[model samples]
Target: MREFDYERAADAAHAVATVHADPDAVFLGAGTNLVDHLKLGITAPGRLVDVSRLPFDEVTERPDGTVRVGAAVRNADLAAHPLIRARYPMLSAALLAGASPQLRNLATTGGNLLQRTRCVYFQDPTVPCNKREPGSGCSAIGGFDREHAVLGASPECIATHPSDMAVAMAALGATVRVLGADGEREIPVVDLHRLPGTAPERDTVLHHGDLITAVDLPALGWATRSTYRKVRDRASYAFALVSVAAALDLDDGVVRDARIAFGGVAHKPWRAFAAEDALRGAAATEENFGAAADAELAAARPQRQNAFKIPLARAVLVATLRDLAGQEAR
Candidate 1:
């Protein structure tokens, strides 16, 4: 690991200003992801502004039925929170579905959203990775890309974002509260992450000084019927090959409303807008669910080894929707 100076932040304003003033400074939460990058020589920041102990660690509920999760809240705590487990079960399920118990205990909400890709090329500094160093070239483009992206990829990079929590948040239409150098702003979770276009180095839309303070989940009464399903090589402690976060609202035998997002298929959480569009006002059936998946995945561009992801993603989406709709029918 590289030598660096560390300072515990006094407050949110101080943390934002400190990191914003220095281009080489970065905020430290629980050091779950950042510390790994530091040891791997992927990132070597001159200063670390410790924000783990800051006041941004509470999970507050508003009268408007919105739940705000602090950035510093541990993943385990967030997942186990009574309100979260009760109201936003999909979010809780997604959180528990990620990483190991030890990691979940130490990982923070902000750190999870800011996590880099798990692609081997991006982690190994010895090889070429456009995400690690722009203009270098993407090693995963033609290399072993079994776990690469099938949607929202560019010639420069095909790496997918690895955040199960973000996928659920996208389906829930959560908003991220950020404190930046300019001021404060709220960005929708779906909009926070962008496609890996020419600039594969940029994972999120957040500016250099922007600090995520909390994530707000708006009240969607039907969210209680939501669920998250993930498929990987193994059962646990594995990144998803294909995953779905879905919430369905059924009116009699027809779909009244729906929210769907896919993971492990795109640069960011793949929001299934087309699928949702196809489901609304349509019959809640397996055939319709398959058609909805087909509508959304029609634009999928799969690579050689990972062409299977397209069908896998389709199956996962259909199954997830069927399961949610079945629950609603009951």
Candidate 2:
């Protein structure tokens, strides 16, 4: 809605330079989320650096078996890539379980990672949303908050980060490669996103001019036996009420290692590090799985209306681990 200058980036360097030169400039990948925010009046950038045609659209497998996913790669292509489907099935499943086919075809990997929360108040300009205007206050805290966050929530904000791909990547221990005016850097997926502490306005740790070029997924051999389970209000085209991305490495009915992350329950992708720690060397049984889930969710602080998310998250975690354990048995 706001008048802005648009520039097509020649390359990654050009894009980063353009954004760095202009304080009110943002990179344009697929424009799936950015455009919506523009129309909603949530963001009004002075310039839009088009990075859709940048040389970052390939999905390649590295020599060490790790996967390198370009930020400009389409979500559908990433989901259907052979390496992703065969080796990192959890990542593929998470992508497909996200938006519909048309949106997925248009959404880019980087854009998906940078997607904002779907909190109703945050979208409405009239409401008080700390994410939109820090210090104004968070209406979701006491309003209709069934979809708000239950973990890592602050009084300033209770909004959840709505990205299924990031959740799976967190479970896979992926690292995001970024380029900026200074140089290039690799930020762990877990560290890329930030909690809604005092500064709920800042969603990620990225600098103003940082450009995410690619996402490097470490070799997750056990992820082949992984699963992404999402429980939403509807069957399709809906955000997760509680989702689980889990991978279990089992050895003779005992857990050798585990990677677990939860969505729709936290400010960012909630990595179940405690749960994985508890599962290691433990018997692959329902009781043990439940215990691990409990251990990870022990610090969950649910709100008045969204307290159901706690039990829902626990159930999803237990079910996902059980399903993966079953696959290992087969």
lDDT score, candidate 2: 0.92
Q: Give the TM-score of candidate 2.
A: 0.98
> Tens digit of lDDT per residue, candidate 1, span 111-206?
999988999999999999999999999999889999999999999999998999999999999999999989999999999998988999999999
Give lDDT tens digits, candidate 2, residues 142-226. Answer: 7999998888999999999999999999999999999989999999999999999999999999998899999999987878999
- lDDT for 132 in candidate 1 is 93
**How accurate locally, in lDDT, is each candidate?**
0.92, 0.92
Q: What lDDT is reached at residue 126 by model 2? A: 91
Question: Count of backbone clashes for each model?
Answer: 0, 0
Off by over 4 Å in 2: 327-330
